[model samples]
Target: MQDNSLPVDIDRRPGATILSPRGDVDMSRAPSFRERVREAQAGRPARLVIDMGAVEYMDSSGLATLVEAMRNARTEGVELVLCALNPRVKAIFEIARLHQFFRIVPTVADAVEA
Candidate 1:
């Protein structure tokens, strides 16, 4: 179990905003994670990229939070992208068949361009 105490980092790019949540995104951190995503969405950037490079683990709650964010992005007409997902986290998305629904990329640069 990785540390869940680390705060989510939000970065504002030219045409996009990146939300980097470190550590495991479990039930305990899901609310905060959702809030971070909402905050990024509030800015109404053309692209909102979630950098999951440092996330080692994520449970159903985390998945739900992401789904909610995706729905919100859709309603707001914001392009939500995910990037740098580790194998473990990526496998979860694959298993859930959510990778097809999301704009998943291998790098932040790719996500930004996508």
Candidate 2:
């Protein structure tokens, strides 16, 4: 099996914050991911973008974190968008039928605009 454990990177843009997460998001790492996202949401931007293009694996815990992040953003009246999802992560979203819960885009620029 491929080693999927890696750290996720979070960055900022003008109108939105970008989280370029890498590696596997599983039970062991989900809390860290949640903390990172929470930190970003705390900034209270009008929109937040999580770039999943580099993510190689995403399990249920990862999905749950994303869902919670979205909820947090919503409560804060900020738009939470997902962008650049790799095939693996996209598949997980499909499996969970949560592909519609987020505003997904093909690139960071697109997500930032939306």
Candidate 3:
């Protein structure tokens, strides 16, 4: 794992590709995050998981980026999953009712299995 200030770290597994982003994901970092998501999608993996364990904060732009990524993944027939969301971040998704749209799991292992 890297300790850089930047958002994403791409990790490839046997059947899934994980995008782990650290720190707050706001407007300033959402574009970069989106680009990374696109790159992961380009790989055409059977599954794509956004490991949000390191994310302490997220804004509407970040949520928008995720929504866009989900759309792209669906269009390409990729299964997009999210795991390890912090409490605040999880609450945001719940409040937005995005949990209905996303397959959110509590851990990376759960995401991989799902």
Q: Top lDDT: which candidate number?
A: 3
Off by over 4 Å in 2: 1-6
Q: Pairs clashing in candidate 3? A: none
Error of 2 at 21 (Å): 1.3
Clashing pairs in 2: none
- Cα lDDT over the full model 1: 0.88
- The local distance difference test score of model 2 is 0.85
Q: Give a tens-digit lDDT track for model 1, residues 5-93.
A: 54788889898898889888988888888888888899999989999988999988888988998999999999999999989998898
- Candidate 1 stretches greater than 4 Å from native: 1-6
Candidate 3 achieves a global lDDT of 0.90
Candidates' lDDT values, in order? 0.88, 0.85, 0.90
Candidate 2 local Cα displacement, residue 57, angstroms: 0.3
C-alpha lDDT of residue 47 in model 2: 85
lDDT of 3 at 45: 97
Full ranking by lDDT: 3, 1, 2
